[model samples]
Target chain A: AQTVTQSQPEMSVQEAETVTLSCTYDTSESDYYLFWYKQPPSRQMILVIRQEAYKQQNATENRFSVNFQKAAKSFSLKISDSQLGDAAMYFCAYRSGSNYKLTFGKGTLLTVNP
Target chain B: GAGVSQSPSNKVTEKGKDVELRCDPISGHTALYWYRQSLGQGLEFLIYFQGNSAPDKSGLPSDRFSAERTGGSVSTLTIQRTQQEDSAVYLCASSLRPSGPTEAFFGQGTRLTVV
Candidate 1:
């Protein structure tokens, strides 16, 4: 079984600043995928970014990027030029190669201050 | 619909009653998933259906929780003899494919309250 852990329960970032949310997972499989999802007050889950375990280069999607360290089993999400709209509950997820099910962390509530 | 849509955005039922929550995935999507979100438990995966194949129900917490997808489109999650513990937000997601790394579009979710 794979487990994703987000140590921080809540985080705050000033507008125009950058913030990073830490995530770690336990998986024996050599191939897998890591993801970050955002859920606002509307309770709609949205995909933020994704990183393939086989890729050595980190994945970047505009202001959202991931620091994926496969050896350390760590995948962290970084948000740059943070805005008030970025305030939401961020979750780290893991999916093994053989399974389509995603294992998610408890989530970190992000509060972007103006 | 442009995205996954769930029916009865909110459901309130008495304990020991039965309830059914419906999910309509995006057209042409081959994969559908059901998850439960509770204040304390966070988000928990419940079941997944890929096309017409047998669903993976490994995450179902109890036998009272069951789900089915017909024609590989709409799905229904049924809870028999609902208990207070079953109160939570039920979310549904759909993906174009069942492979890993694919993005999933989610519904607003059905908030179930068992009093």
Candidate 2:
């Protein structure tokens, strides 16, 4: 069984600043995928960024990027130039290439200050 | 439909009563999934449907819960004798593939509040 962990229960960042949410997971599979999904107050799960274990280069989607350390079993999400819209409960999820099911962490509530 | 749609956005039911939640996945998607989100349990996968067949029903919490899909489109999750702990947001997602790195589009979710 694979389990994802988000250590930080809450995070705060000022507008235009950068913030990073930490995530770690336990899995035996050699190859897998990591994802960061943001659930706003509206309750829609939006995919922020995705990273594959085989890829050495971190995944970057404009302001959203990931720092994936496969050896350390850590995959952190970095949000650059944070905006108000970025305020939400961010969940770190893991999926093995062999399975369709996704394992998600407890989530970190991010509050972007103006 | 353009996207996954869930009906009865919010459902409030009495304890011990039965409740049914529906999900309409993407038109062409062959894979559908049901997940539960609550303060206690983050997001847990309940079942996976590959074109109306559920190969994985591992995450369902108890025997009171069961889900099925028909016509390879809509799915229904039924909970018999619901408990207070059953209160949570039931989310539906759909993807093109049953395995691998495909993106899964999600529905707004049905907030099930069992009182």
Candidate 3:
């Protein structure tokens, strides 16, 4: 079974600053995908970024990027120039290449301060 | 629909009662999934359906939870003898296929409150 872990329960970042949310996972599958999802006050789960285990290069989406260290089994999300709107609950997820189910971390609540 | 849709945005039922939650996946999606999200907790996988095949109910917390997909499009998650622990937001997602790394589109979710 694959399991994702987010050590930080809560995080705060000042406006216009950068923040990084840490995530780790345990999976025996060699082929898999990692994802970061954001849930705002509206409670809509929005995809932030994704990384394939085979891809050595990290994934970047505008201000959101991921530092994926496959050997270390770590995939961390970095939010650059954070804004108030970035405040939300962030979840790290993992899906095996052969399965459709996603294993998610406990989640980290991010609060952007002005 | 352009996106996944779920019915009964909110449901409140007494303990031991039965409840059903519905989900309408994307127009062309062939894979649908059910997950439960508790307050301040991560998503708990419940079931998975691919086309018309038998669903993968491995993630179901208990036998009290069951789901079925009809016509490879709409799905219903039923909970028998609901318990207070079952109170949570039931989320539905759909992807293009049953395997691989496809982006999943999620619905607003049905908040089930068993008192």
Ranking by lDDT: 1, 3, 2
What TM-score, over all chains together, does every model reach? Answer: 0.98, 0.97, 0.97
RMSD list, candidates in order: 0.9, 1.0, 1.0
Model 1 chain A weakest lDDT span, ten residues long = A94-103
> Where does candidate 1 chain B have its weakest 10-residue lDDT segment?
B35-44
lDDT of 3 by residue, B2-42 (tens): 88899999999999999999999999999999999998789
Q: Model 1, B1-115: lDDT tens per residue?
A: 8999998999999999999999999999999999999985568999999987889999999999999999989999999999999999999999998877999889999999999
Report the poorest 10 consecutive residues by lDDT, candidate 2 chain B: B51-60
iRMSD of all candidate structures: 1.1, 1.2, 1.0
Per-residue lDDT value at A17 in model 1: 100
True contacts kept of 2: 0.60
Q: Quality of candidate 3's docking, in CAPRI categories?
A: medium
Model 2, position B96: C-alpha lDDT score: 91
Give lDDT tens digits, candidate 2, residues B59-113.
8999999999988889999999999999999999999987666788889999999
Note the chain A TM-score of all models in turn. Answer: 0.99, 0.98, 0.99
> What's each prediction's clash count?
0, 0, 0
For candidate 2, what is the DockQ-based docking class? medium
